[model samples]
Target: MKLSRLGPVGEEVPVVWEEDRAFDLRPLTADIDGAFLSSDPVAQVRVALADRRLPMVGEADALRVGAPIVRPSAVYCIGMNYAAHAAESGSAPPEHMVMFMKSPNTVVGPNDDVAVPRGSTKTDWEVELGIVIGARASYLESAADARLHIAGYVVANDLSERDWQIAVSGGQWSKGKSGPGFCPLGPALVTPDEIDASDLRLRSWVNGEPRQDSRTSDLIFGIEQIVWELSQYLILEPGDLILTGTPEGVALSGRFPYLTPGDIVELEIEGLGRQRQTVVAG
Candidate 1:
């Protein structure tokens, strides 16, 4: 099922979205997050759905959709995971995985407005696959074990401000990446059974023109490898978000202009869903 949350920000109600219909998730859990995911709630949702215990959400068509999952505990990101994207930014693919993080608060609804930090001159866009952790993962020994800890996938826009991420901070990336609304996620949290992550068409747009067009197949480090490697280093708790990295075609590549107020940014991944956000001044 496509698990979603809709309504005003912070007042969102959980629901199971299937095609044109939405069913309330309140009967099972108050929210879709760390607690719910860890409990293997998909089985519970399936049972409730089978028994027709889920009621149709009211006025579902007009409700604002929030990020499918609640704010995660951490937003870990891999850098240089896409070879072409790495080369475009003047770097080589790493021999060892390179990772960084954005403050969890940076996450916002997929369609929410993205605020360009004041005085920013090089804000950019990236379309990526986001992994949502389902259970505690520590010292995982293999990809098979890592796979079991994943709750689902979502489309993520790993928005960046090159000026802050590179020009200052003496090389730390989170400084430029932690602006409010930097990580726009969701539309829905698709269960692992619903989609395949190995290869999906990942795309992005600015205003109405195409910018990034690539596939998850181009990832220098695949999904299972990313999760297993991360597990060896940090304790991944339920609901932690891991952005596997983005493909080429960002303003940072210098093939296009940086985002400005009023620019519309759209990102999508096959079978997962899409995200549309407007760029606004901070």
Candidate 2:
């Protein structure tokens, strides 16, 4: 079952998308009182969607799509996890995974406008496959167990400001990555059972041309390893999100061709769904 939050920010309602129509799950249960796309929602909604009496929503409803997970305890990201993207960024494959955090407050619904911060010139876009942890996990020994902990997947745009990311903050990448509106996630959260997150086609387009395009097969570290590795350091909470990282063709891959006002960005991961956003100057 596919789950999503719809309506205005802070007032979104949980919904299920099926056959192009949305089922209003908000009125049916409090599990959806807030964002219900995190870990447990996978099982919760599975039962909810099975009820034949639930009311279905129409396509023209004035609902806004919010991030798949409303309150991720932490937004973890892996840097250069794709081999080709690593090469394009002028870096050799890392011996160990590189990680960074994007503040949970930056989360917004997909299709929202991406704000290019005032006086900023290096704003760029990254199309990444995002994982929502379904259960509490830590210190896992193998990739097989790691897969069981993932509830589902969502598409995310890891918008960046190169100057603040690298030139400032004394080299800590979080400074450039933690701005408000920096992360736009979800059109929906597709349960892992419904889609194979391990092998999917991921692509991004800036304006009208393709920029980042690749298969999940290109990832240097698949979802299982990354999740298992992260659990060793931090407590993987029920609603935490992990951005598995993007593939090659991001604006920063070469020449640093970043986004400016009036540009539109569109991205999608097969099975999970698609997301689009417009660029606006702050």
lDDT tens digits, residues 152-175, model 2? Answer: 888999988888988886968999
Among these predictions, the greatest TM-score belongs to 1
Residue-wise C-alpha lDDT for candidate 1, range 6-77, written one tens digit per residue: 999989999998688999999999999899999987898999999999999978978888889999999999
Q: Rate the local accuracy (lDDT) of all candidates.
A: 0.92, 0.82
- TM-scores vs. true structure, each candidate: 0.98, 0.93
Best by lDDT: 1
- Give the lowest summed-lDDT range of ten residues in model 1: 169-178
- List candidate 1 stretches off by more than 4 Å: none
> RMSD, model 2, all Cα superposed?
2.1
